[model samples]
Target: MIDRRDALAGIVAMFGATLFAPIARAASVQVAVIDTGPPSSAVFTAGQRALVSALSERVIPTTDTPGAIAAEVPQFIEKLLADWARPEDKEPILAGLGAIETRSRRDYKVAAADATPEQQDALLTLAMNDQLPGGADFFDKFRQLVITGYYTSEIGITQEREYLPVPGKYDGAYPYARVTKVFSS
Candidate 1:
């Protein structure tokens, strides 16, 4: 018997990461409870957790709206990894994290979590574009996990995207200009 969640995870894993965006958006409102605990415990060590937190924040930084940290994306990721990921799925992430720390220390003379935001952003940019030799694979998975975790989070649904529980009648001719954010049901 195959679990639907596993199927979904496998689907996401198989496709290009960009393909998951609509799925993430569609699944957003269905998210029930977000774990509100210390993000460091099972999947990541304290230092690793800090790195995850820092990296996630850089991935979805705090602008006027709250960022990934506020959405508890790191904790969500920790839970996902501990509960959902297999050993094969886990190894790249672990290796990727190590690479990030290695780069940070070598380039900035500090751990990734302790590096300045600009420095961290630079590292993330490298990973994002596949410039970091060992980091691209990790960043791809990490970014997808972060996004999936975030959109399903309360902050992402309620704040980053708009949510209206009992929405008014739709206007067929509503101007795109009037739209502020993506609406979540």
Candidate 2:
């Protein structure tokens, strides 16, 4: 009894409804999206993982202090990108990685990892200085994330920075020398 157009519309609507049913149900249930993927595997895309690894190394190299890699900074970035980053932010992140890779390949004829430590440092410095095109903000974001990940790690909080759990119990005023000594030691 229905016209051809009406019948086609009904079929299409049914197909769409069936296709999106699970998604609609999941949204209604409010599932908590968590990153349970293996950390050692390719967590981020190749470009993102490369950038994260490089930034972590640059921020906290293994030679001097325990660096971002040791503190699982790549894992942090992976989790952050999967759960927290906006869709709009992904372009810049990708663009930044591409730019860096291009620069490294063109300038040094090697990938970032294959480059010398000095070259790595120079690339990072240039990125930090906003010298690279199309990815300065991305570099800045990566640097900030690496630093944040490192400083918030168990090693960083207990070892590198002053982390006081209970500040209320301490005296309101203290001498600079005493405070500095307590914090430093």
Candidate 3:
């Protein structure tokens, strides 16, 4: 007794729900998707934001130069996630954040952000050392992405890491110590 239009609508609704369920569950996913070619309707959830914030904090904590939070690393990560990564890859990224949070909560009796610098370092080291629960490959990918994102930022490239764009046309015969000034990208 179902009309063709009704059946089509039901199918569409189901498809939409399935596609957006993870995004809806985590708002950060939408934020990640933002500016990365996804529609504006896709939005990040509280948990997602927390995850992004935590990851950013760990990657580049508040220091004399600047931290990941200040450089908007969360937004950067979100965009990369939505634009560069495949749909199947997103869950692992989110789960990586969740794993860090869960581990922090269990080990330090606090959220990842709430943990001390030493604790944060320990967690990051552990994550870097061991295969994450979600998967070893996913963890490695996430770490690589985070490091790449952090180091590529303006503050990161110029201040934190050595970045040279021109190097004054590259003197092939110049002495190593003579090149004192670094270049910017």
Candidate 4:
């Protein structure tokens, strides 16, 4: 008869092997092309889509790895807003995008997407600090969504962060200095 503890450990070990297997990468990954038709019932307009892309990229810019744009986070956000979010849940995001544009045009005479990187960063900083009226709430939600989308994407999981397959025995005294990229969990 298998003891409960022994059975549980066996099950965990079995699943862990399957779950932590290394991913296979293709030389050219094919991405689905979304329809670029008129926005009759779409959650985001063309301009709003552009704004979301720009804002999300700013949140996770290309450093040593691919950024939010490369990870398709904007498309993820659009799908979430269209399929999952309630009307009330989307109002703040739309309002925030408008506010960002307003601030950008007022300060730099250009839209957020057209503004320089420095200008975009400054605007993001202002929004983050709650200096932009009616924008703080939007920033909080948008930033969370961007991060969630990025971290869940393949580029984020495998490229930006280190992926450890089948973690070894626990070492409580693991040296922080030896740690390079953050481990994807």
lDDT of each: 0.84, 0.70, 0.67, 0.83
Can you list the residue pairs that collide in candidate 1?
A: none
Could you say which candidate leads in TM-score? 1
Candidate 2 clashing pairs, residues 3+ apart or interchain: none
Highest lDDT: give the candidate number. 1
lDDT of 2 by residue, 1-185 (tens): 55677576665542332243345443556677765665433345775576668767877877545778888887877766665554454566667777777889999999876778788788877877788885568777877778778777876776665667766676667667664313421
66-171 per-residue lDDT for model 1 (tens digits) = 9999999998888778765554677788888888898899999999999999999899888878777667898899999899988888999999999988776877
- Please give the lDDT score at residue 48 for candidate 2: 57
What residue runs in model 1 are displaced by over 4 Å at the alpha carbon? 1-41, 168-172
Query: CA shift at 70, candidate 4, in angstroms?
Result: 0.8
When sorted by lDDT, best at the front, the candidate numbers are: 1, 4, 2, 3
Candidate 2's TM-score reads: 0.69
- The CA root-mean-square deviation of candidate 3, after full C-alpha superposition on the true structure, stands at 13.9
User: Can you write out model 4's per-residue Cα lDDT over 1-185, one digit (the tens) per residue?
Assistant: 55677576665542332255456755467785664443326778788788899889999998889899999999888877775555577888888888888999999998788888889888888888888876789889999889989998899888988788788777899998998879898
Between candidates 2 and 4, the TM-score winner: 4
Better structure of 1 and 3 per TM-score: 1
RMSD of 4: 11.5
**Candidate 2 deviant stretches above 4 angstroms:** 1-27, 30-43, 166-168, 179-185
- In the order shown, what is each candidate's alpha-carbon RMSD? 9.4, 14.3, 13.9, 11.5
Clashing pairs in 4: none
